[model samples]
Target: MDTATLQHRFQTLLEQHRKIVFKVANTYCRHGEDRRDVSQEICAQLWKAFPDYDEQRAFSTWMYRIALNVAISFVRSNIQRERHAIELDESIDIAIDDSTRVHETDENVRALQAFIEQQDPLHRALLLLYLEERSYRNIAEILGISETNVATKINRLKQRIREHIA
Candidate 1:
C-alpha cells in the first residue's frame, strides 16, 4: 500500500479500534507514564504492520494480535515497568456506581490488578482480554489458540482470580 492508502486505512482502523490500544496499555502498564509508552509502542507496531493486514480477517482481530504481541513482549523485557503504582483518579471514580460501591469495586480491582501483575506476560494478556469480554473466537485468533483452549484458559484463570480474591 502507498502512503495515502496506508494512512487512510490506519486512520479508519484507529477510529474503529482505538480501545484496543487502551486495553493493551492497561494490561501491560501500572502507571500513566508506562501506559502512554506502551500505547505509543502498540501504535508504532500497528502502523508498521498495516500494509500486511489481510482484509479477509476482522480488523479488530488483526489489531488485537499486533497490540497484544507488542504488549506481551514489552512486559517480558521490562520487569521494573511492572512495579509502578496505579493511581485512581476521577475517571475510575466515574466508573463506580456510588461512593460505597466504588470503594468496594476499587478494592476488588486493586486485588485483581495485583494478581494480574504476578501472571506471566501471555497469561496477563489473555486474562485482560477475557475480562474486557473479548469473544472466545477473537481471543483464539489473537493468541493463535483454539477456541476450546481459550474457553478453558479463561475458566481456569477466572478460578485462580477468584481463589486469590477469596
Candidate 2:
C-alpha cells in the first residue's frame, strides 16, 4: 500500500481503538501526566509497529498488545516516575474518560483501584486485559503466555480481588 493510504488507515484504526490506550495507561499510571506520557508512547509504538500488523487479526487485539506492552515498559523503566507524580491542581481529565470506569466516588471502585494499584506491573497488565473481557486465548497471545497459564493466573487474580474487596 502507498504511504498515504497506510497513514489514513492507521489514523482511522487508531481513532477507533483509542480507548485501549487510555485503559492501559490508566491501569498502569498513578498520575494524570504519567498517563498522558504513557498514552503518547503507546501511540508512537503502535504507529511504529503498524506496518507489520497482520490484517487478518482484530485491530483491537493488536492495539491492546502494543498499548499494554508500552505501558508496562514505561512503568518498569522508571522508578523515579513514582515520586515525581505532578499533583494536578485540577481534576484528572484523562482518568475520567467515557470508558468502562466505575464512578470515582464509589467506595468499592476505589478499593478495587487501590488493589489494582498495589499489584506488580505484570499482574496489573493481566488484570487490565481480563477486565477488558478478552478471551483467555487472546490474553495468552497478547501477553505471550499459554492459554492455560492465562486461565490459572486469572482465577488466582480473581480470588485475590475477592479477598481484597471483601
Candidate 3:
C-alpha cells in the first residue's frame, strides 16, 4: 500500500482500537506521563508494522499482537534497566460518566490495577487483555499460547485477585 493509504488505514484502526492502547498503557505504566509515553511507543510500533500487515487476519487481532508485544517488551526492558520504581498508588483516571455511580467501580478498578501491577509483565498483559474483554483465542494468539491455557491462566488469575481483595 502507498504511504497515504497505509496512514489512512492505520488512522482508522487506531481510532477504533484506541482503548486497547490506553488499557495496555495503564497496565504497563502507573504514572500518567509513562502511560502516555508507552502509548506513543505502541502507536509508533504499530505504524512501523503497518506495512507488513497481512490482510487475511483480523485487523483487531493483528493490532492487539503489536500493541501487546510493544507494551510487554517495554515493561520488561524498564524492569531490567531498573530505571524507576513503580508506584501502585498512582491513579489511572479513565473518563467515566455518572460520577455519582463511579465510586465503587473506580475502587474496584484501582484495586485490580494495583494487584496486576504486582504481577510480572507477561501476566499483567494477560490479565489486562482479559479485563478488556478480549477473547481467549485473541489472548492466546497475542501471548502465543493455547486457548485452553489462556482460559486456565485467566481463571487462576481471577481467583488470585479475588483472594487478594478479600
State which candidate has the highest lDDT. 2
The estimated TM-scores of all candidates read 0.82, 0.87, 0.84
18-72: candidate 2 lDDT, tens digit per residue: 8788888877776767889999999999989999999999998888888888987
The most accurate candidate by TM-score is: 2
Clashes of 3: 0
Residue-wise C-alpha lDDT for candidate 3, range 37-97, written one tens digit per residue: 8899989999998888888888877887888888778777787554445654533345433
Using lDDT as the measure, name the better of candidate 2 and candidate 3. Answer: 2
Model 1 misplaced regions, further than 4 Å: 80-105
Name the lDDT of candidate 1: 0.78
Candidate 3, which segments miss by more than 4 Å at Cα?
80-84, 90-92, 95-107
Model 2 stretches with alpha carbons more than 4 Å out? 84-101
In candidate 1, what residue range of length 10 has the lowest lDDT sum?
93-102
Tell me the whole-model lDDT of each prediction, alpha carbons only. Answer: 0.78, 0.80, 0.77
- The clash count for each model shown is 0, 0, 0
RMSD of each: 3.9, 3.0, 2.9
The predicted structure with the larger lDDT, 1 or 2, is 2
Error of 3 at 127 (Å): 1.1
